[model samples]
Target: MFRVEEPINKAADRMLKTVQLGIFNSIIVNRLWTPLQQIKFFIPTGHGTLLGTWRRLAVCWFAVCGFIHGIIEGWFSLYYDIIPGDQSFLSQLWKEYSKGDSRYVIADNFTVCMETVTAWLWGPFSFWAVFAFLTNKPYRFVLQLIISLGQLYGAVLYFFTEHRDGYAHSEFGHPVYFWFYFVFMNVLWIVIPLVLILMLGDSY
Candidate 1:
């Protein structure tokens, strides 16, 4: 169940902002697919032969990262002030995700600034990295290195800040909420970026 500290109508004016946004209840009728199944959709048909499986997967990872940073985190950067009480699909998604990190529900300052930078900066860079790789740009590895380093830095700060707070933002040990939502989800940013960085090092 999605819960928050604020009243449902606390941001009545902001509710108007999401009138056109569809409700998640009606939009998400089916169960989510596994990551591997979803990745198939991101593989570029023209580039598939050139990319091979691992390279295609890496590109798909950047595509996913771009979507999350541009669309999902971008929404947070815009409407975070109204999230706890907002009823839009994205708002509801944030509320659900907040179960693992209550800082989102409350719109913590650090989270807001971090996500804003990520949305504006890394978001577009991620897409550019995809394009660079697909077209075989001379600077693809440089872009990859910058983005991976930035993601690594941001992710480390995210975890470190939460750790300093004694993990008060989450349930800490709840199997799904803590382990899957908080740790596992954020850890991907750390692990994948680190691997990409190492790959860049090998290429040099």
Candidate 2:
């Protein structure tokens, strides 16, 4: 079972009062299906596509990214002010993820702005990239390059800002919170995007 700690920043006390977070178990439940279920739903199961395996996986990645940015992060951008107190599934999900980075619960300025940009810009573009790839659009690689670059840049800023703050937001070395949630999860944005950028360069 996972437990939420008090906000690390004293300035967050006022905001924390409005939050009614509960003890989160490793398995988070909501009215909707789990994230894995959602991902499975998005992933193409057929091997009939003209695209190769790696290309199909890339398309799946963008589809997942679109869902996350458009739906999940979009909710955060819209309702972050009330998320701590809100018990909606998406809100609960964010609350759960806040265990890894409390800036989300406190609605830190950088987080809010960054998520807003991600939701509005990259969200739609992700879906567009998926569509372009599936349809074999001439500009598919262009979209991939742009989206991958944005993701990489944003991810760099995300980590660098946390480092600059001396990693005060969450427990630095905790297994689930620090290593899995904070580092491993966010690092996908960095590593995968870097790979896609390199692949694009190779294609040129």
Candidate 3:
């Protein structure tokens, strides 16, 4: 009877030890799983894919305007004081479309510096957007969002600086063109940033 009781006692001890080890493993797994899920932050998700759909129109818009701002306007700002300087494509442009009592205000020292900075900034982003679009790189979603915010900042500076002087006004200037160039142009920067924030936020 003593020998039989000894084996039964050993068997009970082994069973209890196995159950404790299982509990320990379950606790460890739960703790590790949460942080692993959070690491998903680095990867693009549903909303990022959604924003990708707008790549054609959105990136194109940035690319085209960015070329004009970074190159065309940049060249003019560097040379002319927003006045009709002798003759050039850009100067001709200013003469045709620009309207103001002090049109030179657009290329004032302050405005020229801002445009130059924006030109340098937008040039790289436009290149990146085009490259990313062609490659279908998901990481570009985050880049797009970042650049969009920067664009918004630059737009605000441009708008307020222009506003301090005045908007383009002439006897028969089209409200349509004024709104298109000054209002809608800057407004898109603000709007697109918000859209990118919403759509690319999942990647955060």
Which regions of candidate 2 deviate over 4 angstroms?
A: 1-49
lDDT of 1 by residue, 72-104 (tens): 999999999999889998888788778789999
In model 3, state the lDDT of residue 56.
Answer: 51
lDDT of each: 0.77, 0.78, 0.56
Off by over 4 Å in 3: 1-52, 100-106, 164-177, 202-204
For residues 71-168, could you state the per-residue lDDT of candidate 2 as single tens digits?
A: 98999999999999998888987887787899999999999999999999999999999888766677989999999999999999999999999999
Write model 3 residue lDDT over 1-204, tens digit each, in one string.
Answer: 122455877767644644554465356445544443443344343455433335455555555545656666666566656356557655654453453223433446765666676667766676686566545576777668767777778778766766665543422243433553346535877787777678665643
Residues forming the 10-long window of minimal summed lDDT in candidate 1: 25-34
Model 1, global lDDT: 0.77
- Point out where model 1 deviates above 4 Å: 1-49
RMSD of each: 7.6, 7.5, 30.0
> Residue 192 CA error for candidate 2 (Å)?
0.4
lDDT of 2 at 187: 99
lDDT for model 3:
0.56
Better of 2 and 3 by lDDT: 2
